[model samples]
Target: MLSDHDFLRYSRQIMLPLCGELGIKTLAKARVVVIGAGGLATVVAPYLVGAGVGYLRLCDDDIVSVSNLPRQWLYSPAHIGQQKVRVMAAQLKALQPAAQVEAIPEYADNSNLCRLMSGADLVLDCSDNMTTRQLVNAYAMDAGVALVSAAAIGLHAQAAAFQPSLCGPHGNHGCYRCLYPIDSQRAGNCQSEGVLGPMVGMAGCYQAALALRILLGDPNVPWSQLWRLDSTLGEHQLLRIQPDPSCSVCGHVSHSNASSDDSSIPNSGV
Candidate 1:
């Protein structure tokens, strides 16, 4: 049960038809793990906390650099040499003192992946590189957890929500590997390219939206759809997607409808 303060603080979110009191309470019990504390996690964490996600594990093993300040909104000159997760952890506490936010200053490699993701309700891949995305995808597949993956470089951004248990017939609803099978072929990253600050913020917010919808069990959401945003050109596109039948990560997935228990909102076509 939410205290009066919690209800008052999140009244707006609670008022939404999709996320009413029940949804808000569901969010309050949700546990989310975010990979990367750079541009995306900085904003994503705050949104999740603000909306009352009960617990959050923020994972990153990087340090704050002068170059990262332009996009990472949580840090300043004083935090230049500090650990990314630690600094963000403090900021998240300040945002919602009651929320439990842990700064796990470790990279999400195969060695620590399971530990990092254990008991997580949702995982967000806000990572900058393809390797991390692939690793996260494989882990999410094995754990049978939903994943919201997004990446932004320059003016282009791509995001998707992968719900393995919610797969559709005709081989629909694939993981990240379904779209980009080979890491060698999936090109472009922030390191090799320039990106606008709003671009990361934009993509991160979209990722947060998808995670919240899943947490709330919003029945109308079109799970496993690829959303592309072009901030430079002011264009956006949403394409329905499915897990690759031969995907090494989710190849064994069965071609059956999701359990009837899953919630869905009408595809608003927004």
Candidate 2:
């Protein structure tokens, strides 16, 4: 049911064997919620919009700052001091007026996370902080929505997809908490450790690819795969992760409680 304009707009993507008319239709109908309008979002939003995602909800409370210019490519010098969501939403609309773009000009906290994520087909965590990533993961798991979590610092980046269903009938695929372990410590944030702009873009692109695969119902791509790219070492690693028996989030016992109290997970200070 693609319109003439849509057919023309997505011709190149549609021509690909992995993404034909069916994939384009899936992309057009997908509703995605992206948390963070910073470095990763710069690449993700535009690609999603261009690919014709029906609805895109953007959440970011920060404003465009001069310091963010190096990594956040969506903003221009003129957009300095403008609200991140507002400016990014405007730019996305300009790129694809057909896509529905909602700008939540506030930080996504426990109070508003449910509202922001309600009815979303998928969620993308592009935020720099580990706390927000955990929050988003918890909420997505609770809502039974797929989540694509990604992070990049310096020349290193990691991307993973979490689908609750893959946790198996007994809740198998480990949750974010299982992967990081509540007691584990994180390094530092990109700001503190310094991140290369292209590295962030590379991670974001990987996230987008996985998100598209999920939307397209590609059975070959599992929901528990982790892709790591280290430009520093010129290495790309793909790890197959399984659910942990004692995971605090998606474990058999945790599934019954649906608790958000991950206080047991130690903060990595990232």
Candidate 3:
């Protein structure tokens, strides 16, 4: 049940069809782990907190650089030398005091991925690199947790949601590896290739919206689907992600919910 204060704070969202008092309550108890505190995460954290997510675990070991100021709205020129996680946490708390935000000042690697995501109800892959995305995807499969993965490069962005447990006995749909073959050569990154400032912001907001629908138990938006945005071209598209039976990460789960298609966007950089 929502308190009088919560009802007032989230009245608009509470009135939505799939999201009512029940949804608002779900939001109040969901624990979300965001893997990166960069561009995608910079926008993701605030929206989750503002929307009333119960707990947010922010992990990033990188430091802010003067060049990151343009797209990473959470940071300012004065915070160039600060840790991204701590700075992002402070800002997230300021957005919603009722939310508990933890700042883990370390990168997500094999050694710490499990600990960082031990109790996460949902994992948001707002990370900038494929390595981290792969790690998170593997963890999600093993933990039986849902994941919302997204990435943006130059003018293009792509995102997908995976709910292995929700996919029924067929197992699960494809994952990050299904989209980007693991053994493939590396792709460009923001440092080497330039990315439009708003591109990532658009992707982050899209991911946040999908995440909220999942958190609220809404199936209208659909998981195991891929969405792509071309901000420069002023357009977008949605397609089904084919689950690969050979994928080491999610192979155990079979997903026959929809026809398999190639919906992966080029990995220029994020």
Best by TM-score: 2
Kindly list the per-residue Cα lDDT of model 3 for residues 113-150, writing each as its tens digit: 77887789999998888777877776666566789998
Regarding TM-score, does 2 or 3 come out ahead?
A: 2
Q: Report the C-alpha lDDT of model 1 over 116-201, residue by residue, as the tens digit.
A: 88889999998888777887877776677789998899999889998867643344577777778765434588878889888898
Worst window of 10 by summed lDDT in candidate 1: 261-270
Give the least accurate 10-residue stretch of model 2, judged by summed lDDT: 261-270
Instruction: Give me the runs in candidate 2 sitting further than 4 Å from their true place.
Output: 168-171, 183-187, 253-270
lDDT at 98 for candidate 2?
A: 84
Error of 3 at 169 (Å): 9.1
Q: After the best TM-score superposition of candidate 2, give how far the Cα of residue 81 lies from its true spot, in angstroms.
A: 0.7
lDDT of 3 at 109: 73
Where is model 1 more than 4 Å wrong at Cα? 167-171, 184-187, 253-270
Ranking by TM-score: 2, 1, 3
